[model samples]
Target: MCRTSILPSTVKAVKRGEAGSAGELRGDFDLSGDLGPLYANTGSGIFGRLEEAPRAGAAVPVGMALPGPATILANVRGDEVREYDIEILKVAPSSADGRDLVLSVTDPELLEETGGIVQGMSGSPILQNGKLVGAVTHVLLNNPEKGYGILIDHMLEAAGDGVD
Candidate 1:
């Protein structure tokens, strides 16, 4: 397979809204880059011993990193506000082409408590369609609930991927 190497520093966090805003929060992530080899030892048979390496530059496509100082559009209860530091473990290809992306969150508690996805989970980078698809935008934060994602194309197109 392909072998890619990404530095840990590649990742960055995107904050949402101002601290004093009505709805404000922030999310952390590991930027896309050349990730080292990921072992695939199933222990099924002798062949399982084979160590598989990732493709070179296997990180999510360029321009996928969500911009900083993002706005979190989420509904909160009471006046209790909390922020979380999220780690993006993996970004892989999706079945669809340029239409859908697959993103894996490292924290299971967040997933279990919030179902599939949760609030403040938006703006998370998803990797699929061979490019930076978008970021998580919303979440149910309740039963049978999942999170929502927004296409990066529009954000990038509007922001121009450059800050003044």
Candidate 2:
């Protein structure tokens, strides 16, 4: 599908509390440009393959470790990118999805900002030591202050068609 992308902006646009209506499509996407070809669309995340040669910059190579300081960029309610400081608590090679890195939200202002991670936050890129390690994939339902991140390397390898 050329015009296929299941973005948070599109998903959030669905109107709720309607009669005899699954949802409504009215709001425009917050993306600067279209999201390319979409391969997998799930409730948890979307897997899309970029349809281009290759672009330089923006994405950093996946880092090997995550034990120190890191930063996360996430869009909580719309297109507003918010930065939060965090510290890697632990890393496990085997998780629910094979490998997952645990993170502790150390940003002093995060809780007061949005009551910790809210909806539509998974897949937020996680940068450690100025390198892209992975993304915030899941947050503990009981404890919102902590979350799980999937290594970028692991994701690229899983793509099969290679990363763009």
Candidate 3:
């Protein structure tokens, strides 16, 4: 049997307004790196075991992801991870599959460069207060500046991390 990843080999890379051959706003994506074996695709996000050790970081509780200021680490440009400012607009504690945070891009530079959330940014980590909170999930089709995020807690749960 052939196994495949939740995310396709070709990442979605394009601005929303950019038209395709059929006059449709289709996006394209480039494969930057490998994420190893992804075990879960909760619809909101994907969870996987990495091939290499990850950087040191702290994992905060989902409750910490309140409506407030946050930042997302993304690589809009080739391999260069940059932190962009954002705001947590709302928290849906009861949401299933990790769509627990609503966020909007507030960084002037990010907005000017990517024109809000484009393709190839689905799994960018959303951080707040120097801790990992959630990840960017789906972008608002009408307004690229706004998007949904999956709480880190949900992701951890889906990954079978803490269950006894």
Candidate 4:
């Protein structure tokens, strides 16, 4: 689960629906998960065992994250997941609260469509060099184009799933 105040007993994720812009909800999902405290919930992200796991992707060390070209997989509108271009502006490997990747949205289509980063885009995968590096965590309210991301390493560490 992404960072949110309300943790309901059940979470209904988006599966299929019409696309939407900022401040609007889109998509639909029949898949739902039952909440339990056994899951690892931390400042970085939430991790839990699913009945059927999704295929695992290549993982990259967070230390490799730098100021360079990258892409974020996000479902900003409807159920269509698209890869949006982004620039890794800065990296804080030592960040304690998961604000490791400082990035900006540069994709013209994403910028024009959703007006940069908006709500419900958190936990979007940040991929670089064909590897998973981090996840979008928060967006700059004053400048939606800018935002912070949590390093995948940090998330894995928080979940006690791996070690350096």
- Once fitted onto the true fold, the runs of candidate 4 whose alpha carbons sit more than 4 angstroms away are 1-38, 53-63, 161-164
Per residue, candidate 4 scores C-alpha lDDT tens digits across 50-163 of 444344544444545778999999876544678999999999988767689898999998777766766677788898887888998877766778889988878877888523
lDDT per residue for candidate 3 within 66-114, as digits (tens), equals 8999999987654457899999999997886556888898999987777
Of candidate 3, the 10-residue stretch with the lowest lDDT total is 16-25
| lDDT (Cα atoms) of all candidates against the true structure | 0.36, 0.63, 0.70, 0.70
Kindly list the per-residue Cα lDDT of model 1 for residues 134-162, writing each as its tens digit: 66544433321333344565444434323
Measured on C-alpha atoms, candidate 4 has an lDDT of 0.70
Which ranges of candidate 3 are over 4 A from the true structure? 1-35, 55-63, 161-164
Would you list the rank order by TM-score, best first?
3, 4, 2, 1
lDDT of 2: 0.63
Error of 4 at 38 (Å): 7.2
**Local lDDT at 26 for model 4:** 45
